[model samples]
Target: MHPDVAVDILKKAETSLVSYRDTGFADAQTSAKEICEEMNVEAALKQKRLRTTKRQFSYEAPDEPITDALKKMEFSFFNVVVDMAIESLRERTGMMSDVAKKFSVLISFSSELEKQAKDLCNTLTSGDHSDLNYDELIVEMQSFPKQWPKQNMTKLDLVFLEEKGLKEIYPNMWVALRIAVTTPVSVVSAERSFSKL
Candidate 1:
């Protein structure tokens, strides 16, 4: 999947999880209530503090309505789950950004993205690795975009270059695009972007 596509997926996932979770909890609560009613018993809920400090006393909670108890359950369980999912998505968003930073060079060069290209080069060359030439990459980045038949293209797909026959003339871009294309990717935003591709 494209980094942008993957990022787009993660971007909206938190909202979707939040939006849908409430309905899911409501449905589950209703189902549980039905089960409890079929058993012919009153719904019951009580609470007690689990711990007490040396100078502290635990408080016993009075009986509460089932609805209140369920709400508490949602806050303790479902809310935590949703929060964890959101946090995981946030981490993945950062990862997708890093992937995009490395692959930004694969897109048509822009004055703004030049820094990313340089950074990518520095990263690839760091710690006794020198597979890429910074100067050559810079030259190629500036000149390579002109080869495109359309200068205004959005979301460049490197696979299309298969027919362009310009790899030798723009080896650095070829390498960068190859890396980007080969990078592992995922999900709906990715699904949509690849469909567009």
Candidate 2:
């Protein structure tokens, strides 16, 4: 962008910074300076020709005296900062359009590579059965119904474990268990936040 246009952008951005950040003139001035530096503008010209308003107090003008003073600083002007950054990025790479297309392609490829890696890992580890503790417990729980032991105590133990796992594994069921334990069988407290369940 031209230096004049860049200056305008900086001025607008400074106005934005004032409102958005609740910062003073010093902060806004610093922002303008930073923008100038980033754009590699000449140092002398980068020093903005800031206009300072002087109080012209008089008996004729007793109330509001500030005139031509910019009001309501807006942060929308910070788009200049974004534009400058994008320009720099384009310079480092080839062009803005080409760089954006390349970035999207890279992202797509990376996502596919990640999915492939996860699948490969799962396939390699599928049958290396170093039985996790939970795995063994799950097997025992599944087998109890088939065995159908004649003893009442053994059957009760299996039923208890199965119920415990159901209540613990699912969040909604766990909340329901808490309600069952705490209150008089009323469906008020735990019924919320369980729409999907």
Candidate 3:
């Protein structure tokens, strides 16, 4: 899954746990109040409700299974899961500089992005493409998007560059983008395959 999606799932899980706890608490409180009223307890009156409230505020609700389940749950486990998810997200996509560079490359071709791309390519290739004019290639890239409808262009990856025109425009940057996006942060699949074997 994408790091953003993973983070969202983690947040939802945490929120759901809290919501469950709060709903259980509210239900228990309401039930206690109802029982007090049913028994015609004088302390159940609005002005003296606290005296009766103290009597009915037991955490162990024999009749309310949901409330009992909530009380039995170890809520700290939710915090642990949320923390692990956050850490995994950070490990996967915490390279802000790389993310920003890719964003600039995908959004719109410009001289600045070209320079950055060239810098990145040079670092990867040890200056083999140093003589290439990245800015001119970026200018060519600007026209490639016009071939497709505005709404059709969602993710700016190699799939969009499979067209012959785009391939000829900025082959170097396309290769770089493909490699960057395809690279996996974890080798869980490989590990699982080895284990199965």
Candidate 4:
């Protein structure tokens, strides 16, 4: 993976460092740049460890208790930090420092996944409509949710769909929308795209 992408992932992994909805995560652009650079090293180490089956126990004597050591390490520095962050996240209402710190990776992964999924789903659902009707399909895709069942959508899902321009057709309907964004048929289409692409 590119160093830029790795840095993006680390930025997301550091979710405990920023606020919800806030754009600026790091102190300065220079600091973010430095953090991204440092993340490259951490990402490399993580990937290396993942690729290798050799556990930490391999470094110790066979006579030592690996299970005990593992338990002891469970409450190590990293785990404590994570626990603290989770607690803070649970208590907060809006985006907290933790969520913002993870901005880059979260944004990157979400955008990529949504894009790929939408592309595949659209491709499969799209028929060989003539050029004259192509525009209608786009409009229908944008407005279809207006005619959908409402009342079961999550706040996050509502926020997301609104951002996608789909909610413009039925602004009030969003609160009552009981829509399942993807179906098994769409999932199969996505899988097929994965195979073809």
Give the alpha carbon lDDT tens digit for every residue of 39-105 in model 4: 8733111222223345575555544433433333444543565566655444442333223322222
Task: Report the lDDT of model 4 for residue 55.
Answer: 52
Best by lDDT: 1
Which is superior by lDDT, 1 or 4? 1
TM-score per prediction, in order, is 0.69, 0.18, 0.42, 0.18
lDDT of 4 at 21: 19
Which is superior by lDDT, 3 or 4? 3
Off by over 4 Å in 1: 21-23, 31-68, 145-156, 186-197
Please list the residue runs of candidate 3 whose C-alpha ends up more than 4 Å from where it truly belongs after superposition.
Answer: 1-76, 100-104, 126-136, 142-161, 185-197
Model 4: residues >4 Å from true position, as ranges? 1-14, 17-60, 63-134, 137-197
Over 22-56, each residue of candidate 3 has an lDDT whose tens digit, in order, gives 46555655787788789976433232222223345
Superposing all C-alpha atoms, what RMSD in Å does each candidate have to the true structure? 6.6, 23.9, 12.2, 18.6
Worst 10 residues of 2 by lDDT: 99-108
Q: After superposition, how far is residue 139 of candidate 3 from its true place, in Å?
A: 5.2
The 10 consecutive residues of candidate 1 with the worst lDDT sum are 148-157
Q: Which ten residues in a row are the worst by lDDT in model 3?
A: 43-52
Clashing residue pairs in candidate 1 are: none
lDDT for 88 in candidate 4 is: 49
